[model samples]
Target: MAESADASGGGENKSVHVCVAFNVSNSKMPAFCEAACKLLAHAKADKGCRRFDFQREVNWLRSVSNEEHSLFMVRQGWDTADAVEAHVKSPHAQRFDGTLVSESMLVCAPSLSLFGSAMTTSDLAAIAAEARATQGSEAAEPAGTSSRPVSAARSNGSRPSS
Candidate 1:
């Protein structure tokens, strides 16, 4: 599944999302790619993992072929930060490190947006409500909670902007 983001304001049961960029070495490209794909599958199967996948940058140069280094982007999501950390320490990850990290750099950081689910007006309103509810006010309800307002688009057939 595609990676989903955390829109909940309560910060309870927050999904931990990470985007990692990798630079692989020359001779290790094939092996590294194989290991990475395996690790991604393994991560996705782990508990609390919503998504785990890798993407390679497409090259525009058709004739010259400038393949100095390949870039890979990995997206992973978990129910909590600790769960994500545990996923990183999994056996598949350890195998990945042994196979791909000999001469490569891995840069990981949080993501503002993720791959799953499109944005909608109702989604925004629900998030706002959740913020208000958590802040101890009647202004709005919580997003994921049952107290939040349901999406009108679902019943009225309203389409959100792209």
Candidate 2:
């Protein structure tokens, strides 16, 4: 992992950082955490990978993120734009991404934000398009309640917890 540099740093900054949040059910929290451990191992192996943090939020009832159920946030940083892109395309990322981007593990697509000098607005748009493609397009549903099957939001009387 390289040193994280910003405007304060002496050289050009081409770093990128991504923050993603997932709303998971208590039933799947343990499994998700276990998967994250493996993901971290992959991150550690990438020299471009700098920061990786996974945090559980207990006070979601008061959270501004609007994530109801249980929530976990992952923040990762890379030294270069190419590094960020490559990390995501890596097999390890795909292994968990299939589950993370699916309703079986998350109530919905995780809230995501990308920031850095190396990434551009077009890059953000492309990333969003890719996410939509992964989730598959959804037809318009009536207002009120969602007909979509949200596995993590199932009302089995089990409260969502990390």
- The lDDT leader among the candidates is 2
The global C-alpha lDDT for each of the candidates, from Candidate 1 onward, is 0.58, 0.68
User: Model 1: which residue pairs collide?
Assistant: 129-141, 130-142
Spell out the clash pairs found in candidate 2: none
lDDT of 1 by residue, 1-162 (tens): 122344432333465666665654445677777777788778888888887878765666531113455556677767666677677688988787766545453322212233323346776788878777766754354555556465554331111112
Per-residue alpha-carbon lDDT of model 2 for 44-157, expressed as tens digits? 687688898888775645653333457678888878767877888899989878866663777665676666656556766777787687455443444545555655754522
Residue 61 displacement in candidate 1 (angstroms): 9.5
What C-alpha lDDT, on a 0 to 100 scale, does residue 111 get in candidate 1? 23
lDDT at residue 110 of model 2 (Cα atoms): 66
Distance from true position, residue 151, model 1, in Å? 41
Span of ten consecutive residues with least summed lDDT in model 1: 153-162
